[model samples]
Target: MNRQDIGFVQSSINYQFKNLQLLEQAFTRKSYSEEHPEVQNNEVLEFYGDEILDFFVTKMMYKRFSRILNNELVSEKNEGELTKLKSILVSKESLARCMYNIGFSKFLYLGKSDEKNEVYKSKSVNEDLFEAIIGAVAADCDWNYENLEKVCRTMLDMETTNGYLALLVKEKSHRLGFG
Candidate 1:
């Protein structure tokens, strides 16, 4: 990505990278790295990002549903129930939807064939990009929890109570006949 494009991305995500290379690496696919040996792929970042996202979202869930988890709320939930909700929030499909909604997965640096095939439109690709970005932020911020949390909240639109996560929960409840 060019400087202007990267700037736009930073602005859109509301976070700037201390090491710009990490940001660049986050968007670089393994295929792209194969074509350009000098560049690193985002696979490692994606892996780390997967863990970071899980940790961050799980923590958020524990905090947000404290009463339910502790059996204090009217709709008390057990550990398994909370786990199910967390799984839904961090699922690949949910992350892909968030990335797609952001409308920036198209900027991913892909291999020639993948680019030709429009791989960015794929759910798995979108999911990877989402995690890759979080991974990038984790590295750039020196593993600061606040920075990671902020980025996740911004990218996933989970700042408000009625945000994407809440909507997803409502949808899941309806689907499971629990609404």
Candidate 2:
């Protein structure tokens, strides 16, 4: 992608990275990285982003579901319940829907062979790209908790507006027997 395309993608997401290369790396798949050894795959960044996402989501859930009594549930049950809720919030399908709705696929760098596969249309690739992008943003920016929360809220609001995760928070609350 050219500088213009990168700029466009950044504008579309309302996020600007100090290091543009990080964004480029985030969009790159392992196959592309293999072909261009100078570039890196986003797998490691994705790993870190997953943890960051979990931390933020968990905090959100705790605040949102304050009625849930800690002493009433077993440790395993609490963990399982939180996991289920987090899964709904951070699932590949939801992330992919958010990315696609925002025209992220236009900026994605895919191998020629992979582009032809039906699997590319699936949610997994988009979700990976989303996580990678988050990782890149975290690494490239001096994003504090407040900034990260703003980004998460923006992403979630977009998803909710698009109906990708409209009922997720409510449904999870109901399922957990929280008002």
lDDT of 2: 0.72
Model 2: C-alpha RMSD to truth? 4.6
Local error of candidate 1 at residue 171 (angstroms)? 8.6
Tens-place lDDT digits, model 2, residues 1-179: 79998987677566777889888888888866777788788898787667777787777877665554566522433666667767878888778888877777666767666667744466898888777877777887765676567666666555734442446667678889997
Q: How high a TM-score does candidate 1 get?
A: 0.83
Candidate 1 clash pair list:
none
Q: How well is each residue in 116-143 modelled by candidate 1, as lDDT tens digits?
A: 9989999899889888999999999999
| lDDT assessment of candidate 1 | 0.82
In order, candidate lDDTs are 0.82, 0.72
Candidate 2, residue 46: Cα displacement in angstroms equals 1.2
